[model samples]
Target: MKNKQLTFFLMAALFLIPMQVKAEQVNLYAAGSLRAALGDVAKAFEAEIGNQVATEFGPSGLLRQRIEQGEAAHVFASANMEHPQNLVGQGQKGPVALFTRNNLCALAQPGQTVTTATLLDVMLDPAVRVGTSTPKADPSGDYAFELFGKADQLKSGSTAILTAKALLLTGGPDSPKAPEGRNLYAWVMDEQKADVFLTYCTNAVLAKKELSGLQIISIAPELSVGADYGLLVLDGASQEAWRLALFILSPEGQKILGDYGFVVGGLPAKP
Candidate 1:
């Protein structure tokens, strides 16, 4: 009888341990804009969960398109809120969770005469060249257009000039016709191309030295120019993925997001 009781206890413990362990894996796809920050978060999350968090980083819009195309991602963390909302609207995502926010800035090449105050001057300068990603392919690119449009309203023809200055892309690595990462600012950054490239605040955080020794110029706040990072569990993901999603949104989970430069917020309480 004693031996039988010990055997039963050991069997139950073995079953529960794996169950507890399996409850923590989260597979995630995130935007390239958040990559530098999220890497830290992913590490911390894994340490706590004793499970893995697999992440794929790319342009937000491209990541969203992949999810829509039936890629088996368990969670989607976008640099902008639109991708999550679009997924929700299409019935691909669940309840929306706004996790963080970010600001925008202009990137310029080294030795450039343009200051942020002088950014408009350069934008309007026929001698200087500007580049940006395409609106549809990149949210940053889209935000660039919107910001330029606002600039036009603030001044005159600012939109046209900014758009005109961009290199504009049509696809990312997944696109067969354009199987490459779209770095709108790549040429300018490498000294192979343009004089100015518009990029995000976090990009400034991660690539300050490489981005043409660029400094930000102030733009008006009302330019429809903010990014809200969001996360949502994917449909048809494994149970492990769903558990990981929950873990990321938990307080300990959200704390990790801060390390990655995400403006943290608690996940919405279950309805």
Candidate 2:
């Protein structure tokens, strides 16, 4: 009876050990734009590797600021290559893979008919209310500003229209006072609150189903800019974090990113 009891206890221990191990969670920080695509990858990764991945999503610029301020995140994914490189330059060394590339797009609510021939056209149309993140805090916002600058140069007389557009798109209720809402572009897209918003191509792809009433229009002159998703393991990340980062930049990871409409590049581009 004693021998039988001991064996049963041993069996139970063995079962519980792996269960506990599987329950270990890795923390990942990603840009808000990557929420949909990463959700799929996280689900698949957990199933395949038997590990849990907890994700924090936000603007890449904000994530960089957090890391610089000594925030505790194991894996970091940035919306731009520059942020990851900045992290690496600051001595956080790891593989920086360009998991995706996104262009600027103007998204409008469903049934909102507007041909955005010029940035002025997009801004001036009283029927088209615009929204965007604060350029000072978010790269998307910065890009939006660049778009406006270019527009202002091309169409000088439309400054008031652009100013009005800025006011219209400036903030949501949850926006912070300083930087405002840099990542809320998707919320506007999802809720149909604003007629137009500037957001990433990947975001548009992910929301294509839910935002059936919205349309994505390309920005002319290409803005000569694109957002690249990059992954890095911080200086003192755990083994699990390293593994998660590795898995995210792997071919399997790139494939998942592609499925979400991200243009995955094998290596980070030269600035």
Q: Rate the local accuracy (lDDT) of all candidates.
A: 0.69, 0.70
Off by over 4 Å in 1: 1-25, 169-188, 209-212, 218-224, 238-243, 246-262, 265-271
> Candidate 2 residues 95-194, lDDT tens each?
6876667777777776666555654575667766777766644667666666666665666756456655663343222454322432344456665566
Give per-model TM-scores.
Answer: 0.78, 0.74
Q: Name the top TM-score candidate.
A: 1
- In candidate 2, stretches whose alpha carbon ends up further than 4 angstroms from where it belongs are 1-24, 89-91, 116-120, 125-128, 157-164, 167-193, 222-224, 266-271
lDDT for model 2, on a 0 to 1 scale? 0.70
Candidate whose lDDT is highest: 2
